[model samples]
Target: MVLGGDFNTSRPELLAPIAQIARECDGRSYAPGDASQEVTHYTYVTAPGPAYGTYTSSKLDYLYSTDDFTGCDSWTQKADQADYRATTVPTGVSDHAPLYGYTCGGPRLSWDMHGSVDGVVADCSAYDNNGSTLGAVEWSAADGGAAVFGGTGHLATPTPPVDSRLSLSVTAWVKIAANAPTGAIAALDGSRISGFILWYEADGATWRFGMPVADADGWNVDRVIPTVPAVAGKWTHLVATYDAVSGQMALYADGALLGTAQHTSVWKAAGAFTVGRDLVNGRPNAFFHGSIRDVRLYDYPLAPAQAADPTL
Candidate 1:
């Protein structure tokens, strides 16, 4: 979606050039219409100590949406990443307020793994969200060709194309090599905080759809785990979904509904949706030790019935 803002005016209508830019780009933003007010803003925080002080400001934030954005969800303020924006908004509370737009419609990012040893994976979607392999990650002939990660490698996408705070679904054909303890199957998270993660727990041998309900940290994660065991060396269709309006998440393994869980608040972990690994608090945590194929990412939550068969 097109994001435009941080201009020298209060009225969006008055901003002719910005509006034109949005029109030309064919995207939307998280701009509000209350008029003459910009409540959620990005900030530049200062050192927090005896001489700590946060009393400066810069331009306003740009959080608008595209014309085609279906049911544009709310634009949330960005939070401080490792206290980077420096911290604290003008209100003197909270860390950061990022503007996120949920472009709910159809598939936004897709990867059809078709080759072995591919360095640059193509994004089959209309948007150019191509991913690249990092470290020891490689495209293997397993599962009709897929990316295999060996603990210390992963596939990284550019700036996230879909918003993490909105209704969304992620699906893939996964093959577990062996159970270690835990590893991120796939996820969307911040630089040091996670937003949502589709992971596995060897202790329970279950596939879980997790979200940090209480906070953006890793420990506060709430999950909806499937009873099905992630049989090692076998391919299983895995699906994880989140309903933004309801604050709920669901998981499915091989077309069967695992279960559901509730997360009443918008747990913010705005960052690139990744493959083969999920990160939090600047920790490696765990990388997916398996092969992931036919990864499809949709902007809206998929119903239980539809989860059985996702269109590539």
Candidate 2:
């Protein structure tokens, strides 16, 4: 998607340039009308200063998206109160009004483990236009009580999201209190374990996303991302996706693509799907020493923009 705050799409000269870009990218404007009543850009015709006077409202700002954006369900432009120059007191907050687009059809499992003071189980608010219980996970509080897990504080769902027939994507928000030598973020382990983990080398200065692949040698295939700077004490959003159709695996950190590799293995998780630790041979290992929240899983690979947009 491409967005402009002060694009001035009302004029042919300015709109021509944006139109060229939209054509090259195969995108369309959010509002496809040519009327000043659809105006987002407001101005004053009788203001005190020359710079602020002799101007009429016009639709200037725009949002354009590609053809693959199939879930654009609605668009709303703020038309009242602070959105316009007339309704605001002492003018307005900005020359342009706010615009919003709503979408649907994402996330097979969403665990917004919030609103809990302290608990041993994290509830899964699991829904995907269709609803079912992914089940609550068992998690013990870590020592010092900041949600750190040192091989002890782990969680598991009775039903796993892994299936050999579907593509997969996982996303999480994590805050690392102190860097671990190595850690597990989430895993689906049974007789043969396969999942996303992180290895922090260089004495906690760097970290990498590790995906253990199931192979003939029994989980010997390891795909590792290049080490990145470990920013401790800050929240970072991580996204990892595996496309069964494309045979591609990608890892992202803080909305930026880190690396990609081919992964053709079919995932059939039976033992348990877990978080905060990895289960190898049906035991917890590589426990994460951090706080995890907003962990989501999907049956389809997410677009890079969707994965990166935290609001979605």
Best by lDDT: 1
Q: Which digits, one per residue and each the tens of the lDDT, describe model 1 over residues 1-312?
A: 566545544445666665664541212322222222333344444677653443343324455544433343213333332433453334333443433443445578888766433578888888878887777877676546887778887776877766777777899888888755678888886767667788878878888888776444447777886676778888888888887766778888888888999865564565777887887776656788888888888877777877898453
- The global C-alpha lDDT for each of the candidates, from Candidate 1 onward, is 0.67, 0.54
What TM-score should be assigned to candidate 1? 0.65
Model 1 scores a C-alpha lDDT of: 0.67
**Candidate topping TM-score:** 1
Q: lDDT, candidate 1, residue 272?
A: 71
Can you write out model 2's per-residue Cα lDDT over 120-183, one digit (the tens) per residue?
3444545422122222323324321223445456666666665533466777776665645466
Which ranges in model 1 have alpha carbons more than 4 Å from their true place? 1-105, 116-118, 214-218, 310-312
Off-target runs (Cα >4 Å) in candidate 2 are 1-104, 115-147, 195-207, 215-219
* Backbone clashes (count) for model 1: 22
